[model samples]
Target: MEPIPNPSSAHPITEERPGEAPIFDWDWTETLAQSWETLLLILSTFWCILLARVVTQKLQLHDSPNLCYAVEFGLVILPCILLITVAVDYSNYIGFVMFSGTLWFLRKNRVLERARTRGQFDLGGNRHMALSVLRALTHLITAINILAIDFGSYYRPYRKSLQFGAKLMDTGIGLFVFTMAMVSRRTHNWSDLRRIAVYSVLPLILLGLARSATVLVLGYGQDIHEYGQHLNAFFTLVFTKFFGALLNILARKDLHLLPLGFGILLIHQFGLSFLGVSDYVMNDDVDRTNFFNANREGLVSLPGFVGLYGLSIYVNRWMVASSLLSYSELVRKLRRLLLVVLLLWSLFVISAYGIGISRMTCNLGYVIWMLAIGSTSLWASFGAIDFVINSVMPWESSPSDEQEKGLVTRGTVAKGGDKSIVSFTISQALNQNGLTFFVVANVLNGAVNKFLRPEDRSNCESVIILLVYMFLGTRMAYELLKRGIRLA
Candidate 1:
């Protein structure tokens, strides 16, 4: 094999190897590639159908006791599968295709109109809950699939998967909203359902099983054989440096988790940076063991790293405060903090982009990804602001003409002589579904960045930056929540 080019020193931009061109046709030589594409499409669609059915059933059984089951499946199972599958292959394109197809079906059936008129409620008046479940499920699945597939690795397959998955998720969500609109129009008084249907129970159970199986079947051997040594070392370090601090926090109630979390994060950053720099220095020859090469190798292995990080954060946080605060309070504060951090982060990221574009040999794709992160952050920040504002503001009274037209205007007078401000406000905020999108988008961005960027910096630097931003963001979020709660 030809010697690996030195990334630090002068290196020529290499030409593509034969058959490595982006638009290779599906001939005998590329049959395996084509087959993989086909398999992904089929599997993704199957999963989509399963997801849609679960969502539909959840909405239908809104009053039932199994409501939480749907929520759990949507939030946990769907996202996990999405993450794993997206990492596996070109599943994202399949999702997009499926989503688009779903949309067309909904449009043809007039489902959208019905959904809008009904306020997207189910027949039993739990539209919001149902839609929330569905949206979460769809997004998680989509995001996971996207993460699994490398965009540039197999260009055509990756592109197709992304397109298909995007369309599929969008359509699934659209159908859900449309159904909800129709359901919301109906009026009924009902109790939450307590009965469980086989349809719901079986699917969720199977999905759970599948997710576990997938993790084990795909991850077990690789984790043990390939990454076992390094992973064990990393975990040991994490335990000594981070987990120990976390346990102390748990034992001492007075201890603050955030500071501990931040400190651990900083340590992680330092460690990663040292490793990256040391690896670079040791591999002075123009070999595949250089800093950039090591970085790429680490990047490719980041999902496991991030999973550990998430676990560390959760364990630390949960140990200190059983219930940190109420969801409402959390949401309120998180929203405000998100807005401020997003603004600052956007500026910093933009500066990074300028540097990357002007000085570094970055491509259009890198620029685009950076821009997307900025855009999504801005969108999510604004969404949180909008939710907070609407929640606090009094609703405007509807005109008599709107009343005559039987339209649910901004704020209508109720029989109790109180305006429907509270109801309207809460409804509007929930309907935006901003929180769901924000989480999904952030996760997706992280996954993309982990894979795409040139791994010049050490793990320490990356971890440090991540921790610093997260700490600042969380702190701001806490303050915002406190302020909002006080105002209320």
Candidate 2:
């Protein structure tokens, strides 16, 4: 085996010394460690969904979404960051809070009885509560972890280990791609390609170029291993979107996406396994002199992510179809979703044992790992929405009207002064323009890193800094939603 290269040496322009960059220098944990961490994240996520319902629906708490934004900041985003940061050491305490909080709301409100009698509240196929919550949390967690990973309170295990195994931050880029695919509308006609390019691809390319330029100019500490010498998160997103758009136009039907996606994955994995592609990407001794070698991680990983994008489009098609089914049929479809999650997890385990998980290469194990996590999160969020939250706060809309329009405004106030069932929520706000929100968070992360040395801070200081940063970051999304803006 070739000797491993210093992760920092590839980015000699950064101010960081050899092997001392706070974010880049870390040995990752075994895959088994991710299970416990994932459980806590899921638990906190479920609790956030429940609490959002109880506060906005049951209690009629929306005097103004503006005033209530702080309530969300404290209840939903705060505990979540705390669970992963300052409060991480107290797993039992945090776990009890998440468990008891979710249980208390469920039992105290009598979810089952309400669900049985509340009648059906259809918000159409696309604006699903379960999927909405999942998408929101994806943005929330990704935003938090980017900045949190620099702090002393942030555990090393949660950072992107790069070399092997799965970590929370490691899953961020793939989840973003998957979530974007879930809502991607099928494009028809080459004429639409220009609009897609201008609206979608252009922004991502600009963001990628901007980030790459800023990092080099500011001499920010970078982990070249994460995306190679020049490529960053934005470029990965750009390529994913660009390629996915071409696929959508060429396929011309949702039905074609599933099988085609699977075929792509199989072929990609074959090359990695048999063609020695994985060996080349993982070899640290390789020099980063050419564009391909310099950005090999970003380029090689594109196929896996594009395949994931195709697969997610199929999953979204399934969900849209499932939403139109009768209650019993919907339940069965949901059960099937659970089974899909199980199958993905099994595949992930098999792949991990066979080739090991590597985010750098976006190898078979990494792709399956992403699918398993994304599917499980979607399942849990959907289960909560369908079984509990939907019944807890029913939408008062006629069945015929819902069927005809197949849409409901997210921030609509219920008629007859009934408590606003679908009032403004942090998740709803963030979902308005998720990509823009992510960009704002990245800017703030860079700013914070420039002024503060989080690696040297105490737990209390770190938590306070993170909370302040989160507030400022979320505020942009929330305020933009208030102004009826959607920057994609």
Best by TM-score: 2
**How well is each residue in 132-208 modelled by candidate 2, as lDDT tens digits?**
66788889888888998888778666777555667678788888887887766766767787887898889888888
Let me know the TM-score candidate 1 reaches against the reference structure: 0.29
Per-prediction TM-score: 0.29, 0.87
Residue 324 C-alpha lDDT in model 1 = 29
Span of 10 residues, lowest total lDDT, candidate 2? 20-29
Where's the lowest-lDDT run of ten residues in candidate 1? 356-365
Off by over 4 Å in 2: 1-29, 100-113, 116-123, 397-424
In model 2, state the lDDT of residue 306.
86
Count the clashes in each prediction: 44, 0
* Superposed model 1: Cα runs more than 4 Å off: 1-255, 271-331, 340-344, 347-488
